[model samples]
Target: MKNYFKFKVLPYLLYLLINFLYFTNKKVFHHPKLKDDEAFIFVAWHGDLVSQPLNYFNKRPNGTVKTMISQSKDGEIITKVYSLFGIGAIRGSSSKGATKALISTIKEIKSGSDVAISPDGPRGPRHSFAGGVISIAQKSGAKIVILSSKPTKYWQFNSWDRFVLPKPFGRVDFYMSEPLDVTNLEFEEARDFVRNKMLLNIVS
Candidate 1:
């Protein structure tokens, strides 16, 4: 029932609020660290995902981008939202059957897809680290880039991750750090490195 509300009911109603505020306030900043003809992974703090995507995709150089998401009702709404922007979302996340999710992510990347992830999402202690992304990058040999956004004006949801919803036409500044190549380390070491990199990028 709760999932039903989050995915089906609330999002549509929130659309008016999002559209009104986002369209009305529209300043954005972007940074990129991409390579030509190379596949990569993008990691962003869960709290910054909403506005970060709005800022990053405009400069995606690559025409098609794919994202990984949870399979809950909220995930359904998110998938719909991504579709509206012509982005492809793969349904899976860490908290629920993480191994399976990682496998799916690996397959997608091996197929030459540029993927995005929330390393501390699908359920969270509000930005705490998780191992899935590190494992994915280590196995697939994809360079991971961490990015974060701070909205000049927005609402912060009281959820586990304090999700940010930017007001229409608001100014959102995105800070993107250089990519961290994970092809050199073992599983555990790579995981810790990626987690630390994400934390540093987000907390700045």
Candidate 2:
């Protein structure tokens, strides 16, 4: 029983503490250029996920957002953390069963929920965007919004995506760029545009 608590419950408690510091201590600036009723796709760099949830759900505290995770042990841990924060996770990735994950994400958006995604997640080369996120934007008729966060102090994990943990009581800044529309573009063109736009938002 002690081992069970140590291995399972402890990690979740730590995750909750991290989120507490992130949401309570940060000064978030939201520039919502999009309409409230409009559904949208969200793309963020993996490092920016340290405070992603705080930015997406500010207006509607109970709003639903979906994200993708790989079907691995780490993914399982992340899924639990997201669930605790009221986030929905679809377990798949670009290298794995991406089609099913994309289908789930699209369905969520079509159902009037915003879909938050990390285009360069689940073992990314870091900051390189993929095509699937844009495809969802085109199919769902939703504008794509890029979200990012930069904390004044944090830990960067030495992983493929450089997972971040904002230090306790540190100030974090969230940048939500103006939404991108892909209403009347070809698949390839829309994908390229969204990818480039996200990359620009990350650095700018």
Candidate 3:
């Protein structure tokens, strides 16, 4: 039953869900500095993921958004869902196989693939930044672009990160900050700076 659901049912359901959300919601893009082929690390808070992924996939179909997902049962389901949209996933998390995932992310960025990360994801201290993203930016020479979304109306889950689900036909404001160059900053400083910038643009 688990195999059947994972391989068959889950992907189809997510495909429908993502398409439904994309077609119904009104999206406003704020990516002036981004180019057609330039690679960058996309960062957003985990709580806003319910809508952000779909928005990014629909809005930026020309760019690939590869993200780090954990190597766990839930991650399996999430990865399957992502594949339906042509998004790529690197399996690992801060707790397990994180080093490998980080290396893969850097390589992907250097190779011209855009990467997306929820700096406070897979579990969260809720908007607190993680150092891995900054490290990727510094090493890969990819600018970090902060993304945030606010749905005019939505549901909030009881989960640790207060996961959100925007209502169908509602308006979602998607904000993308100017690209940030983290090469010169120290690890801790870069993390804090990015976190504050994301917080200001993304509604919790």
Clashing pairs in 1: 21-167, 21-168, 22-168, 22-169, 24-169, 25-168, 25-169, 25-170, 26-169
lDDT of 3 by residue, 36-148 (tens): 68898888788886566665665577778898888988788878888777779998878889999999998898888999888887878887777889888988989988777
The candidates, ranked best first by TM-score, are 3, 2, 1
Task: List the global CA lDDT of all models.
Answer: 0.74, 0.77, 0.81
- Model 2 clash pairs are none
Once fitted onto the true fold, the runs of candidate 2 whose alpha carbons sit more than 4 angstroms away are 1-7, 200-204
Worst 10 residues of 3 by lDDT: 50-59
Q: Give the TM-score of candidate 2.
A: 0.86
For model 1, what is the alpha-carbon lDDT of residue 193? 80
Report the lDDT tens digits of candidate 2 across residue range 1-204.
976775589658967786678766656665566677777888888766757777777655667687888887767777877877788888898888899988998898888888888888877779777788877887788888888777777778877777777777767777787888887988888877877766653422
- Quote the positional error of residue 168 for candidate 2 in Å: 3.0
lDDT at position 148, candidate 1: 81
The most accurate candidate by TM-score is 3
List, in order, the clash count of every candidate structure.
9, 0, 0
- After best superposition, candidate 3 residue 32: deviation in angstroms? 2.0
Q: Kindly report which residue stretches of model 3 are placed more than 4 angstroms away from their true locations once superposed.
A: none
In model 2, the Cα lDDT at residue 183 comes to 77
